[model samples]
Target: MIDLHVHTAISDSSLSISEVVRLAKDKGISHLAITDHDTTKGLQEAIKVGYEIGINIVPGIEISAYDYQRDKRAHILGLYIEPGHPSLNMLCAPLVQRRKQASYEMFRKIKAAGYDISWVDVQKYEGGTGVYKQHIMHALLDKGYCGSIYDDLYKRLFQRGNTPKTQGIAYIQLEYIDARAAILAVREAGGIAILAHPGQLNNYDAIDEWVELGLGGIEVFHPSHQEDDRQKSMLYAQKHKLVITGGSDFHGFYGDKPIELGCHELGEECIDELLQRIKR
Candidate 1:
């Protein structure tokens, strides 16, 4: 099986790159992608471990982009990316800084709310990408402030719409690039831009709009997608002639659901089709 979407410590995930590669091998994942949020820093390490463990690691990244019309954000996954792509680096640099600032602000808010946490605590969980909200939550969990990650306790405190003021905790909104710009950046980096989990977007009507912007694929199989959602996505992909992909979206026990590596698989045909679209 091939997983086109996966995260490691470089993002908000608990697993390290080596650990993720090991788990993917154990799960019989012949091909995998380290599409960490906003950064490709883990791809090099993941690719090295994949070589040692006989798994093919595709260099990838998950970029956050906003839809101004709908006023919602979407994640765009770039698969088979060139690790040294200058365009990708230029695109992610500002985002990295933004994430760091946002995390620091959130930490300050938590401290002001009498949580007894500090930037040092959150920094301990960061895996070089930046301090993500998950790292903050991990610090909170470690400090016994939250019972579990993504639970009601977490949502009440950190979830959007339940701001720091609402939950009496600290929160800061991260910035995102325009969705069209994100897709163009992926293409500029010579990567195939795939819409990550259309069902999660809940904006199926906008598929054509993204396709027009050079979206090369769609995630038809995802842990959060229901059977009906998958079918609808498949139909949409066929209608728009888009490549199909899938993944566990694994975060190593950090998510609400217990998602195991290889739990969701992208078909070999789909993988081949997507690879054909890659510039290299």
Candidate 2:
């Protein structure tokens, strides 16, 4: 089985590249993609580890993008990316800075809220690619400021809506490139751009628009997707003659539930089709 979406410590995940490879091997995942958010920095290390561990590691990335026409944000997954693609690097450069700036602001807000935390505390969890909200939350949890990662404490502080006590501590939103640009960057990098987890986006209405913008496929199966969502995505893919892919979206110990490396996966047939698309 193949999982096309995954994140490592280079992004918001708790697991390192080597650790993720080991867990994927243990879970019997034959093929995997280290689709870290906004960066491909981990792919080289993951590819090296996968070679030693007998698993196929596909270089990939997940770009956070916005659709200005629809006023919505979505994640675009680039599978089988060229690690040193100039276009990918160009697109990610600004994002890296943007993420760091946002993280700095978030840390300041949290510190001002009287939490015994600092930017240095949050930076300790980052793997040098960028700082994520998860890293900040993890730091807060580690310092006993929050009981659970996704509990009320998290919502109160980071989520948009909160009680008066936590209202001023809300998360700062980061700027993102348009989804069209993300899809184009993937194409420029010689990778297939797949819409990631439409169910989570709740933006199926914009699928046709995305296709027009050069989206090559859809994430038909995901940890966050239900059976009905998978069926809907399958039908959509069939209708559009698009490749279908799935993955665990693994981010060890970072999510609400226990997300195993290969808990969700693409069958051999789906993998074959996706591979064919990449080869084309």
Candidate 3:
């Protein structure tokens, strides 16, 4: 079986690359991808371990990009891309800066609200060079400001546009590539362009619009995707000639949810077809 999407310590994920690779080998997965959010630093270690354990590891990155055509947020999963692609670096540089700045501001806000936290403390919680809100949430949990380490972030904090205070704490906005540009970037990077998880996005019409905007595939097997939702993506793939992909989206110990590695297995034929599509 093959699982196409995963995260490691490189991007707010608790599991280190080694741990995730070991888990994949243990789960009998033949192929896996370490598609960490906007970072490929973990791929080198994970790829080494995958070779040692006989699991085919595809280098991937989950890039956060805006969809100007749809006027919403979207992500593109770039598989088998060259690590130093000029466009990829250009796309990720601003995102990292935005996340870092946003984290600094959020840390100050949380401290002002009497959370006993500081930007330095928050930086220590960061899994990578970039500090996302997930790291801040983890810092809050570690400091005992929040009840549980597994509390809902959307309900408590980092709900995108939600207010933690009466006026709300100002957050940072990462500049991202639009749908057309993102698709072009993935293609230029020698990777397959697939929509990450449409389940989180409630807009089916927007998804269809993305498919039209050169989205080569859709994630049919995601952690939060129900059978019905899976079927919806499957139908979309069939209708749009999109390759269907699946994964656990594992975030590690920081997450309250339980998503076993290689939990959702893509059929061998599907994997073969996906490879074939990429070769073209």
Candidate 4:
């Protein structure tokens, strides 16, 4: 099996690089991609460990991006990326720092709202890059405030809303990079830039615009995509001659949904197609 979207503790995931890699390998994943959010800090280590254990590790990053015209989030996945490329490093470092700061501000807001959670409590769930809302939610879950990460408590605190009345109490908007820049950076970093789960974000309208800006592929099979979404994405991919890819998008316990690693059972040929585009 080939799972092209996985995360490790370098970002918001609960498992570290080695742990996730081992888990994927055990799950019959011959080809695995570590598309951690934003940062590529541990790609080399992940690749090294994968090689040592006889699994192919595709160095990748899921860029947190935005479509300014539609005001929707657009995440770009850079597959087979040159992890140490100056373009990617320069682009991601600032994002990691800013997101960490944003998490701190969220912690403050949650604390002020009379949540019995501390920064230290949340810190227990953090990985290398910084704390994410999932970490905070995990903290809340630990305190018995909520049943799971996606429960009502999480929605009340992190869901995006317009006015104070509807807005998530601890939510703060982080300025993501423009979709165009994200694709360009992925290309410049020697990777194929694929749209990551447009169905989940309701970001279909921006695909044509992004494709024109060097977007190379689309994620067709994901935990977030339904059968209708899969068909829609297949049509889009075929029309644009974009590569078809998929994965479990695993983050361990930090996952937005409870999903297993390599759950999609995608074929290994998808990686070949992605490489063909990179070669072009």
List the global CA lDDT of all models: 0.82, 0.84, 0.76, 0.89
TM-score of each candidate structure, all chains considered together: 0.94, 0.94, 0.90, 0.96
* Winning candidate number (lDDT): 4
Residues 1-68 of candidate 1: C-alpha lDDT, one tens digit per residue: 87888888888888889988998998888888899887778677788889988999889999988887
Error of 3 at 94 (Å): 0.9
Question: How high a TM-score does candidate 3 get?
Answer: 0.90
- The regions of model 3 sitting more than 4 angstroms off are 150-154, 162-172, 207-213
Ranking by lDDT: 4, 2, 1, 3
Consecutive 10-residue window with the lowest summed lDDT within model 3: 162-171
Clash statistics: count for each candidate = 0, 0, 0, 0
Give me the runs in candidate 2 sitting further than 4 Å from their true place. Answer: 161-168, 263-265
Deviation of model 1 at 229, angstroms: 1.7
What C-alpha root-mean-square deviation, in Å, does candidate 4 show against the real structure?
A: 1.3
True-structure lDDT of candidate 1: 0.82
What is the per-residue lDDT of model 4 for residues 1-280, given as tens digits with 9 covering 90 to 100? Answer: 8899999988889899999999988888899999988988899999999999999999999999889999888899999888878898788788788899999999999999998999999998777888999899888888889998888888899888878788898888898888888899999998999999989998888888888988899999999899999999988999899999998989998777778888454687787888777777
Q: What is the lDDT of residue 126 in candidate 1?
A: 85
Model 2, range 1-280, lDDT digits (tens) per residue? 6788899998888888999999889888888989998888868889999999899998999998887778778999999888868998898789889888887887788787788977888888988686888888888898987777787877766775335554536577678878888999998888899999999887688888879878899998888899999899988899899998888898888877788777344666766776898777
Clashing pairs in 4: none
